[model samples]
Target: MKQFFRLMAALFLSLVLSLAGLAPPAAARGKAPERIPTILISIDGFRPDYISPALTPNLAAIAAKGVSGTMTPSFPTITFPNHWTLATGLRPDRHGVINGAMSDPAHPGVIFGKSSEQPWWWDGSGGPVHVEPIWVAAERAHIRSGIMFWPGSTTAIDGIRASDWQAYHADLPNHERAEVVLDWMRRPANIRPGLALLYFGDVDVNGHRHGPGSPETTAAIRDVDAAIGYLRRGLAGMHRQVNLVIVSDHGMAHTIPDHVIWLKDYVAKEDYALVSYGGILFINNVPGHEAKLAESLKKMPAFIHCWGKGELPERFHYGRNPRVPDWLCLPDPGARIMDGNPEHPNDGGDHGYDPASPDMRALFLATGPAFRSGTHLPVFDNVSIEPLLRRLIGLAPGKDRDGTVAPVEKALR
Candidate 1:
């Protein structure tokens, strides 16, 4: 009887010890959930105020279940530079793509595209960007990646796998673009894109064609919301886990026709080549005309701020990239730089502006295991995004690039 009791006690002790060993560590057990297979959806011109219960039920639902905030994109507040900054977690000066259209005086062969046929200026070769993108980081971590229409993604970087990509063509329909992404997700090899980026340009296009607050722009937002709904439903059916981050490159503002500033009127067209987006203008001079043109632009009005390339505001951090033009001009909100070409009139909405303008604030929302419920962060910069993504994918940081800013701690449960 004594021997049998001792054997039973020993067995009980072993069972207790095993159960204790199996218990998760206190920190891990208390740790908030982590999301898997993150998906970043870029709604080209999404504005945070555009989200309403009536306008975007799907996005609102996400807000109810996850976190949302205003993400400030990089300086000049243009598309390509902001998107590249978001991808690499570096400022435009570091990433090299300074504007939608870049002019390289040093290497005349390096020209940015205004049309689809032009080669991508951000071919990862220009000295603009020094860090590897999140896709490259993820791939190095052995994670698969997929991209659709993210501006700087056309030229494949080493270690990253983009199943498909397209040259910048504003002519493509948004639905068709969505269909391509949906189809790519269905492919057996792409069953779960460890990281996926989807871009929708309709809102931005319509906003530029009309105005940001126009009826046409509102309708376009609804269409984009519906498309997002479709993508969410499709992902649900896949029975795979995912983290979906919805963001915008920048916001739009209405520009009055009377508010247009035609640089050609102030400076000889032959003296300066005008490159502009929204109200921000770049003046590239023909040799000796730089000083005269800069002086001429300064006396116009307080509504516009003019600075020589080397003297640009310290906040802009703009001059390091060779693509930046010789002189930078920033107009007040509700103003724009008109194209000198009379054939193309200056009408509609636009984005490029001082990053401080509320109109320039981009949208950011995350839904997945890693995010907390119904959270809101007051504000964050776009450069903070790349670092957050790198952490989720477990990748090492690149040299010389600013590491990820503090994670949206409030956004995670």
Candidate 2:
């Protein structure tokens, strides 16, 4: 009996040893290394095709050593909506940021961004973001975050902790923006944020000012590229092993000056107010005139489609956001929405169209220890970005949402 007991004990010991061998290492026990200390850089209005040996050397170098692909922004393909979508990992409908300007039919005086004091924009201070952003998720997990000029970040969310953030401003120089980001990364507390978002607006601004592919746009792209190069070198000098994910809100297309559409021309100015940005036009018509204005916009030559607040394209996934206008008009590719008044001339290029258009498809590049080198993945929804960011920072998403969008696994080394 004693010999039998010894044999049983030995067997148990062997099984325990085997199980321990299969267990994950201490560093690898929780999440993939590729998911930590991630940096997402947004170069506004960056087109995938803009990446060439001639135009963007630094981006090319990163792409050569990492993964590159087209990342489709959320529907309506505008900046504010897509940028918010990227942070929330929810469709515009879910997040309620349908467009740059939105009108709340339920609340008589509620208009987002029509005037500075309007309470229409997402109130991060107390309001709930249907899906928690990676920043909030990271903060919940005791991780620090840093955001520089990312839209929607200016409004502080309840649980999200960011070292610093700024409201969206097209006028901020690219180099100055980079410097701010680097300073945040170098914070003495080793506050090198687990997640850092850097945005460069020159490309989009120049694209709107001089038209995409024009000399001014090209120069802006080069200038931003050089800034990125500086950032890359700076990060390396700091010996930070970060996963850099470069992305763009949307791309631009040249618009013919003659094809401009002025909403006031087709609708009574008294009944409707036009809120325009990034080539998206939102007409807030008086309650009774909503239908008439919608119809007129549909018949307009420059507009590709017009929809009532709830009838925006299924693909747009907008309408639900508090910021979406009551009546949304999408101009076709290479079209501009402008006031026909002689004072306001139609010039430059724009992007607020369907994101699927190649012209609106943006650039996405990922590099670092977490990303596989020299690879390309199929296009993905911009909303998937939040999930990847959460994983990198070792945090869980706030809400259990439709999990259709996941991290870019292909980018993992």
Candidate 3:
């Protein structure tokens, strides 16, 4: 009789709750908060002016309905450094991937190339401290991430790798790369990645082989735009909304072979080790010849500017890292610093110039439910992208990052 009374009491309570409309809805119970996906795409070396309706109809359509603006790349305005900065929100000085090809004293006689995948080169596994990139942070927070063709993504940074990543293959066609990303997106929500990165090098490659304004470079731009269009159309077919951001590492500048700063004219090859020579030059003076090398560099023509490592302009925010060379040389626009080698020619196009140069400005565009439509944002730094990405993907602000979301908050809905 007592057991029967307990059951009756439970039924009575349920009935009362239903009458009062206090019972939880069947659809609402046990439901989790929705997670919005974010996709970041990089069109390497794409300039802001390259997004005309005729040249890049797909990109122009995105810009018309999304937030569009120019971004100032970090000091040197190179590929690897700025891309790492976009991922980590730290300057090259802090992240330590200083240039495409660079020397590190920690690994004696080892030069890191653009494709170097050693963990120590990126994560500072055996050297300076390591920084956590977006993928690593997302993975730690139980968010699945997919990285492709982003510099440093090939390595297991901070001992953590994204849920899925691909070793960069230059031969992979841009359209196929987009198709691969779409495949990842087609998975069920529980298995799909919350963050995905896509990259295209056709523009940068053509821009370097041909001048930025050449017909070949224009064809490359249109081709990349078509690939992006494919990705956009695929997302629409899936009936899903994702925060999409498109950017470029840096802009390209046309170069003339006649206006080159041949290093042999200024300093002897034996007097210093040429760490890097191109749009920007870095050299390590041999022991006891620092004074001689400095005096010789001072004689370089006015078109080139020379500075000791720590003496870089305050605006550059560089030179603190030990990987930086002892002597740094920056050539003026349209000029290049070369080693005067008959084999290596720099006649096409180059970057890594002064960040303040108009040619160094990069492209930025974003759109999604998280962003306001038809917003025209003012020029901003590329570092701010990390914070904006974190916000879109629901990650908390990182403590060590140098960027804040304030510059891009106006673009958010």
Candidate 4:
């Protein structure tokens, strides 16, 4: 009789402790209620139009339960720069990830995309340029983060790796990506990640090869949506609510081989390094040729619009960064620049244009416990995403952060 009484007393005490959250159940120990688990997915090259019900049923379903809207990419809407901007919430001018292919005078030989092997160019310590990523804010608050294939994740934050992250892997299948995320969530609560970023390149890849409107691109978008569904099922199996945000770095636009500009006609090869991305170019002029080169490039106004370092449009928040080349150009829609005879496919699509242009707008869709169902927001800037994530995860944002939640808070419950 005494033993039975003792067992009852112990059970009561356990219940009291658990109720107070002083002692979590074995299954939930060390997990934080204040820190929500969030999965941020970036589908490269997924334009807003790519999310129609006919093409992306899964995304539409998520939109029905969450907020969906157009998201404008930062200026010079290319991959690496805009992806980094999404992570840091700062424009390329501040983060110093100037373009897909760029040279930072501060970090000699450390190119942004091609020189990933160099740590100084990527890790936060690599600065004078590498800005603080939003993940670092989560980490400072004792939250663990996991990243799979998100740009800028490979670099260390304050000399420490993202709680865990992987270098880019082209061969990792979409299903495996979903399973990996599920596995991460299944870890013991103490070691489980509170934030995760997943990336898919298929939509962008198809857009570049087959053009954004091609049936092949349609098929790719559907495949990506299927992957999203796979991730949803996996998250549900965990029996825990997870916030999901799907975004794209930039949209895609059609391009034809005939619309190309050959640069060798106007300048010597050594005089400048021509970094072209569909409609944008970062021209690093040799010391003596800044003025002449800018002038020469301007002569082709029929094909490109050249701007001096300080001449970049204010809306872009670019050009001031030292990494910005001596000259910047935005080619006309459907145009591209090359050295002699560049070797890209005859026809496909590209994105590196003015962000305000319709072709440069990316997709934004999110669903989670803290958000209102069926919310649809007016078009918002991609810079606004960082604040939304910070708020959803129970963190106070820095006053100086580049994003504003006011525009997106309408979607919050």
Candidate 5:
């Protein structure tokens, strides 16, 4: 009876030790551990204040595990432009994505017809990036990278692309997106991507359809929070180390129907071809109409402001690129601008105002072996993300970037 009991105890101990990989050393045990993979995620329209412990428990937990703080987005505070900033560490002006939709005489099509969704325009098929994005830099260094649905992911920038990439798709579920990225991370080390990016558009979609504080938008926020939690769990289960970074393009703002400013009310339709969305629009005008529209905009300075390409605000760092419009029309805070019957049917929420506005504050959080736990960093500009990302992936940053390393480096462990 004593021998039987001792044998049972020994069997249980061996099983536990084997599962823990502590029973004995294997031949591969002496090999160096793999360089940790880096996963960067973007949640569009995510506000810094949205990470309430009661509601966004997963994200809150991540903040507690690592670093969390405000990430100020670049001006115009729109989608494609700011996403590019995160990737390239260049402002919209320097990156040459001045607006989501605009007419580039060098690559002219229908400005309004394909404003925001034109992959060909952004993907280097029409016009290429002025600065090297980190993905391209990673590829240059012979490191494999993958990106899913990130703005410009489809762009083979300067004849280089992330080894694996997928363009934007509205119908893909968030969990499925996670699965696809995880599969890429699971590849053999010789071929596996060291840097991967994923984007979530659901919160932005709901934020547009419903105001930022609306119950529907809150539910969307919760959905995003849960997706992040699910992705974290899935990676944790893999028993490998991956550095995770969560970022947002910009936040949302409330608006009223009374705030709509129709372009036709100030100038005739033929004066300029307009690409309109809430907050701002690019004006491509007939040569003579440009001056006339400028005068009209001057008269309505209180309601709106227009700047010729040369006269744009210096702080914005816009207007030098040829792809930018002949004139820019900016609306006051809480106001919406439209060329015709509301360019988008969205009624309550809008962005693209001034980045200085508190309403446009974005979110940033990171948790992984690369980051320091229990650290809450100060607010940093979104452009600074590039240098930090390059460091996290163990790559050198491109020289052309305006982003300095001081802002985001403190997040490192």
Candidate 6:
């Protein structure tokens, strides 16, 4: 009878300690640790230099505790392309989001837009094919994902959307976005998302309107930092093991009104259809006028460089996609390429520049049980991010991924 009472007492004590989180974790008892949740946070148009203890304390704190580095964005250094690259481990050329706006020959009169969720716009399923994104891969592996306004998240890539997703709403406040992610994180383990994405676009917006160095952009940075602090607090309260990976699609560069390059000034509007314009210009030649258009572009100022579709610099790894127009023209750093004259020719800042430009480098900071503490890594291509994410979520690197885990594996424990 005494032995039975002692056994009961011991069991009761164990239950109490476990309930209080004071007992040895499963790992201590020779069981593997629970799967660590992975959260990817994107700060659009964020440059590595933008992070400092005074400007972004929360991000600074995370950097001090984990891995921090700069990521070279895919060629064109545009938001949509680099985001897709980070999510798919494929370059803009391979992933098909070659530019923020592009046209496909099969879809006549249809130009890809920001809010378009058509799988064809992403994977060319309406034409070329579907290249899977990370969320789709996660779902395929039986892992749930919560996507909060990531580009392509709402779309049915591989005929699968994330288990939970919110449509892109530019009006949505940053804190509210963080709250949605926290709510998702709070779900019971059985239903909780193993992989999630949170995106904040205010920095990009402000950077476009007020320049990367403007006070307005600085305020936006602070606002995002506060939201990060809120998310960190929420995660701590939940006592959930999470790997938080913060990144940016591309960095911003200052642009002035005089810096704008008017496309019509170099090429006749009648000779080609301008599919897209900005720092990079995509022009589809009018039938039978290709040679004339090519000849005219040769007179372009030294600031702009034009290339026939398949003839782009091999280093860019672009122009092969049919969606990329016949002629691709890239302007010098800090210059804008406009299809036509606009009342406001210049924004305060812009991306879409050469990825090699210093101002176009994106941000990378990661912290969690899966990462080495206080680690700083060299600049790596943004494509490598997807492989790292796959590793974090316990997924195997499948076939045809452009990024290798080698660049980022050093930051892992």
Which candidate wins on TM-score? 3
Q: Going through the candidates in order, what is the number of backbone clashes in each?
A: 5, 6, 0, 0, 0, 0
Q: How well is each residue in 1-413 modelled by candidate 1, as lDDT tens digits? A: 99999999999999999998999879768955433677788888788889998988988888777888998778888888888888888888777778887766656755676442233355445574445667767766666777877876766565344645566566676666666666666766435467778788889888888878789999999988888888778767876467678899999888767778776667777678766644688768778886777678877667888777778887777786767788888888778766655432467787888888999899999888777788888788888888777665656655566546475866764
RMSD of each: 6.6, 6.9, 2.5, 5.6, 9.7, 6.4
In the range 1-413, model 5's lDDT, one tens digit per residue, is 99999999999999988887854466656767687889999999988888989999999998887889887789778998899889888888777676776666675575522125444455433333456678988998888999988887776666788999886678988888888887887778888889999999988888887878889999888988888888888877887689999999998887767777776787777787666556777777777776777667776547677788788788777777777777787777677777666445437788887787788888989988988898888888899889888898887666767787788677676
| lDDT per model vs. reference | 0.75, 0.73, 0.88, 0.79, 0.80, 0.88
Write model 6 residue lDDT over 1-413, tens digit each, in one string.
99999999999999988886965667676944557799999999999999999999999998898999999999988888888888988888888888888877777888788887888778744433358889999999999999999988888976799999998889998999999999998998878999999999999989988888899999999999999999999999999779999999999988867778787787787899777777778788899998999999998888888899899888888877877789888887788888656544676887788889999999999999999999999999898999999999999995787788999999999
Model 6 C-alpha lDDT versus the unseen true structure? 0.88
What are the runs in model 3 whose C-alpha is more than 4 Å off? 1-33, 124-129, 340-346
Structural similarity to truth (TM-score) of each candidate: 0.84, 0.82, 0.93, 0.87, 0.87, 0.90
| Alpha carbon lDDT at 240, candidate 4 | 68
Name the weakest run of 10 consecutive residues (lDDT summed) in model 4: 120-129
Q: Where does candidate 4 clash, by residue pair? A: none
lDDT of 1: 0.75
Candidate 5, residue 263: lDDT: 69
CA shift of 137, model 1, Å: 2.4
Superposition-based RMSD of candidate 2 using all C-alpha atoms, in angstroms: 6.9
Error of 4 at 40 (Å): 0.5
- Model 2, global lDDT: 0.73
Per-residue alpha-carbon lDDT of candidate 3 for residues 102-137, written as tens digits (9 for 90 to 100): 878778888899778777777644434567788898
Query: Order of candidates by TM-score, top first?
Result: 3, 6, 4, 5, 1, 2
